[model samples]
Target chain A: MLAIRRTAPDPDGRLTGIEIADRPAPPRPDGWTTVRLKSASVNHSDLAAVRGPGFEPGTHRVLGIDGAGLDEDGNEVIVYPIVSGPGYADPLYDPDLRALSQGLDGTWAEEVHVPRANLIPKPAGLSWDHAACLGTAWLTAYRMLFGRADLKPGETVLVQGAGGGVSTALISLGVAAGLRVWVTSRDPDRGERAVTELGAHAAFSPGARLPEQVDAAMDATGRATFAHSLRSVRTGGRLVTAGAVTGGTTDLDLADLFIRSISLHGSAMGSPTDLRNLARHCATGGARPKIDSTWPLHDAKPGIARALAGDQFGKIVLHCA
Target chain B: MLAIRRTAPDPDGRLTGIEIADRPAPPRPDGWTTVRLKSASVNHSDLAAVRGPGFEPGTHRVLGIDGAGLDEDGNEVIVYPIVSGPGYADPLYDPDLRALSQGLDGTWAEEVHVPRANLIPKPAGLSWDHAACLGTAWLTAYRMLFGRADLKPGETVLVQGAGGGVSTALISLGVAAGLRVWVTSRDPDRGERAVTELGAHAAFSPGARLPEQVDAAMDATGRATFAHSLRSVRTGGRLVTAGAVTGGTTDLDLADLFIRSISLHGSAMGSPTDLRNLARHCATGGARPKIDSTWPLHDAKPGIARALAGDQFGKIVLHCA
Candidate 1:
């Protein structure tokens, strides 16, 4: 089976040992099972782990954070890309896994081993490529919108950044969840794309003030959009963050947060229960993950590169059929 | 009537020049009434107003953040220090008035005028000093503990920096409300005092490891105690903060917060309605504000100095008789 593995943390370039290579089939441990990958999605975490200080310093690291496949018994399933300790029941709080790709060998390969508890039955109508996108980014958006923020139907939500996986996921999922989803993008074209292709009610420039303050603001853009998210939300509203791809340090005005009674929820991927809930939500809402592009297992570099370049919306998946 | 006034900001020196000199009674605005102040409590906000940045460089600024007195028409009332606009009736989107204190005159001295809505009925059995203490710090603590954090009885709570007004309020009120209150302080004696006098379950050094984790943690000490507060809470617990008196910058590990699903609630002084609720809660529970000592109106300098030095446990009150 061919895998994308990094042998060293390259500073000036991408993952050092990037190549199509073969490895022995990994056996499943107790309470864990192997997913024969049919489709695996590429995420920015794959690119960051290759060059950034993600996991340990110098070892072969497998990259990919989400996948859809067949369980050992041949039932279709989505591998929620997290591998954790025996005590890792919540999945999100699992000590060994820092949201899928931080330390664990994630799910962008021919086959991947994951805790059985991380597997959710793929709905009959959902395709493998769509299921693959639900693992990290989409689940994160779902938890941010519904679980952490407790957003209500018809409530307005401001989504900072319109073309990334979570941002695009938020537009679609929020709309399907009955929220009036508005999106922000640095590029007007991307904003237009979000409104046209995704389910966003409207889209604007990064600091373009909305006509009305939203009930909640979903901000994965980090410092680049944090102030706008703070300003965009109505008083007593919430700001939820599941990712900080941009810079992290932002001017935090304590007085503003207090006066408005606004809450900031630092949300990561999600719990096992949330992952299951995400599957159910997407299935019941007839929502599918937006796939930017798909490639065969051997041609994973371009998909990873596109995700690293921040040039695409939705997920870039690698299918291994 | 006598009033304590700050003629200038003195960041490092004693808050002086404000005198209990004779003045005409304060004139009331529409929808406002004059309170003949029988007693006013010295909060750190008062000290901050007198000696810190809240004071204008060249204006005579009245100083006090909490008071109890007789409203016009002879009604015994406690002044809710914050005077909100009519917009506060629907607080969901309105900027809270408590945040407007930087520009508005604060409560202190002999007689003060406030909007009628900021008056809460003072129970006959409660002392003026106790009622005054509930005006700002106690109400802030009450909202954080019960209203915002949504704490349940018998749950464990850790209060960082045990001796301040809000921390002491949390300890006393948390105990009265059936929480297992644990507090942290640098001073061993204050910790011991907190355990013995305030009914805390246990006390530890600022960063001392606890025997067990708590359901919630209240942090006002900021940089000095934030990490420990983050560490002390159980998974899925709440970390509530009202002030950052010591300092605010800390190396915040965002990963830890998201993994544990910890929720951080930043609070300030609460609404007038919440102040009334706090007064009622104290009356029902027979709880009194822990007063370290009371100074006469003329001797308020020393009380202000003590509060500024951060040496007092519980509220330092300045009583005007």
Candidate 2:
């Protein structure tokens, strides 16, 4: 089996290897299912794990979290990225799952074994590439809007940083949910495209004041746009976040938070329940995942590089076939 | 009539004056009651009005939110400081009520007018001083624990600071409600007193690591202890804050928040219903306010000075007689 494994943490992304690897196949546990990968998407997480804090030198760590493939009976399914406690004993901070990723192998491989509950049936109408994209970014955006923020239809959502995977997903999902969406981008062209193509009402500079305050603000830009996002929400509104990219450290104005009565909800990945809800929402909305570009499995480096550089607007997929 | 009026925002307590002021006796409006104040308590708001923000320099502003006084016919009543729209709205972000003190004359005076609905029957066994504390600090603490955090009995609550009125009230309320309360104070003596007198199990320095993480935390110290309070909660825990004394700016660690599954909830004073519930709790538990010192209505300066200096352990009261 060929897999992407990190033999050492490398800032240059050169130490990560994509090669034929041999291992004893995982024996199926009573409640687990082994899925053969048909396709998998390259997320920033995949690129980060190669060089970031988790990987130790000389240790083989399997890398992918988002994948779509087939079960033993040939039934298509979407793999939800989060692998936490069997039940909801606090999904975000389960120590067991935290230790496993640093210890166990992840998805970027020929076959991945996951608990039976981690697999959700892929809708017949959705393609493998679309299902793969749904696993992480889409589910995250879905949870941010509906699950955490509870952003209702006809409300406004200001998404900071226009061209990343989660921001793109937020725009599409926000529009589909009848929310008036706005985006912020450093590039005017990208901002315009995000507005015109993604159904956003307008786009502006990262911290430029909005025409009017929004009901909720989706912030993943971290330290850069956090204060602006806090300012963008109407009094008693919310700011929901999933990732803090550029930097995770930020200054919070406690006065703004308390005086305006704002809520700051920090989201990790989607929970199992949130994944199920996102799938159902996608099924109803007739929404298809947006693919920035797809690559054959052998040519995975470019897709990973594109995602790593934050150049792609939508998911970068690696087609296994 | 005598009143404590702030002519300007002055942190030195110099802008506040106890003066002989003249006004028409409050006439009962529809659904309103005119209470000839028997006693009213001093709060940080009074000091802030004298020295904080949003007040015109020449305009006289009466500054207190809580009072226990006699209504017409000498009926003892506890003044409910919350004035809302026709029905109960969520207190967290009611825009109409946010500008309350700025919009209306407050309670630190000889006579205070309140809506008839805002008066709760004073419990016979409760002292006027204790009842006076309930309107502002005690009510706010109750909402922070039960309404905002939904903290159940036996859960651990870490109070960031212990000498302020709300902190003292929280200590009493948490103990009454069966929660193990821990408090933090910079002064060793205050910490000892918090444990020995106020039922706090232990007390630590503002940012000192606790023996164990708490299920929920209450913070009003703002920039001074926000980071520590955020770190002190266990995963899936809550941080509820109502006021910020030192300052309102603080650095936030977004990664820590998401990784720990912590939620930051901002609380304002509270609703009328919250005040009623708090009074009932006090009535049941026989909890009395921690009065630092009381002054005759003629000389409220000393108490006001103690409040301004943050020198009091609990509430500073002004007695009308």
TM-score of each: 0.74, 0.85
Candidates in order have lDDT scores of 0.76, 0.77
Give the alpha carbon lDDT tens digit for every residue of A1-321 in model 1: 778777665665553546667886545567767888899887666776765765475655577888888998999988776655555336555444554455666676788777777778888878888888888778889889998899999789999988777888888899888999899888899899888877788988888878999889988877777788888888778888666677665656555666577777778777667777888888899777877899888877777777777777667889877
Candidate 2's C-alpha lDDT?
0.77
Instruction: Quote the B-chain TM-score, candidate 2.
Output: 0.87
Write the residue-wise lDDT of candidate 2 on A23-120 in tens digits: 55545557777888888887766776755676566666667778878988898887766667654455665645741234556666777778777788
Q: What's the C-alpha lDDT at position B101 in model 2?
A: 47
Residue range B1-321, candidate 2, lDDT tens digits: 566665545555564443435554434457666777777787766676766667665666566777888887698888877666653246455567632245556667787777877778787778888888888778778888998788999899999888777888888899889999999999989889989988889889879989988989999889888888898898778898778888987888888776666778777777677877888789888777878898876777777777877888678888864
| Candidate 1: residue B80 Cα off by (Å) | 3.9
Candidate 2: Cα lDDT at B63: 68
Q: What is the interface RMSD of candidate 1, in Å?
A: 3.1
Q: With candidate 1 superimposed using the best TM-score fit, by how many Å does residue B24's alpha carbon deviate from the native?
A: 8.3
